[model samples]
Target: MIIRSATSDDVDAIWELNRQIGQYHFENVPDVFVAPSHLDREFLLAAIMDEHRLFSVAVDEERIVGFISARMDINENIPFVIKRPLCRIGSVVVDEDHRAKGVGKKLMEHCSSWANSNEAYQIRLEVMSFNSKAKSFYESLGFKPQSEIWAK
Candidate 1:
């Protein structure tokens, strides 16, 4: 497995990987995740060019198998509190066949290196409450629950 920076050529594969994750979330929480559509492609393209964003892909035999995208987030919307920058994992997805083979871990290690170099104090991501597998994967990486969002 080769982990490297994402290029324009990888966009289509990345989009497909992203769609799989979106489908999973939509299946698990339709209220929070919309069905995958062309609009997501535009959103991802913008993310690729955004200065605060970092995108990487994992390739095997010249095929893109996984990708991770993160952005530096400073909580500017909240007032009256000292704000610290966070490295927020926007999306991290590995192909179903390639999972459990360390692809995700390599992607995250790259993200952590980028975050630390950028002076981000924390790395954060949100997993749907119903996705126990994802929550467990994150927990194994030293992530703990900071808060929960409850809905009726």
Candidate 2:
């Protein structure tokens, strides 16, 4: 599989993957994520143009099998607080058929490289508590549990 930066041509594939993951999340946690409102192509396109964002895809046999989108957060407004830049992975998904084949890892490695090149202090991503596999994957990648957000 080949990993590369996302372009407008990959929008359809990215959208489909995003839709599938969104549905999965909604099913896993209906209260946290409503099912109907899914990601749109326009948002993907905008992400491509945003200077602080990084969107990439993994392709095999000329088809997009996975994708990851991340953004840099520069918190400069808080006085007395060091404004260190951070890279946050907003979303990442791999087609079910392509899972466990290293697609997700490749995508994440690319994101980490991008973050490192941009001088980000740290890379952060959020995974739902229900997604044990994903949590395991992140931990294996050297991401330690930082904090938890609980809900009623």
lDDT of each: 0.88, 0.88
Against the true structure, candidate 2 has what lDDT? Answer: 0.88
Residues 50-127, model 1: lDDT tens digits: 766899899999999999999887888879855998898988899988988889989999999999998999998988
In model 2, the Cα lDDT at residue 54 comes to 93
Q: Judge candidate 1 against the unseen true structure and give its global Cα lDDT, from 0 to 1.
A: 0.88
Off by over 4 Å in 1: 77-80
lDDT of 2 by residue, 22-73 (tens): 8888999987887735446678778866766898999999999999999988
Query: CA lDDT of 124 in candidate 1?
Result: 89
Evaluate residue 110 in candidate 2 and report its C-alpha lDDT on the 0 to 100 scale: 94
Candidate 2 ranges beyond 4 A from true positions: 36-39
CA shift of 81, model 2, Å: 4.3
Residue 138 local lDDT, model 1: 93
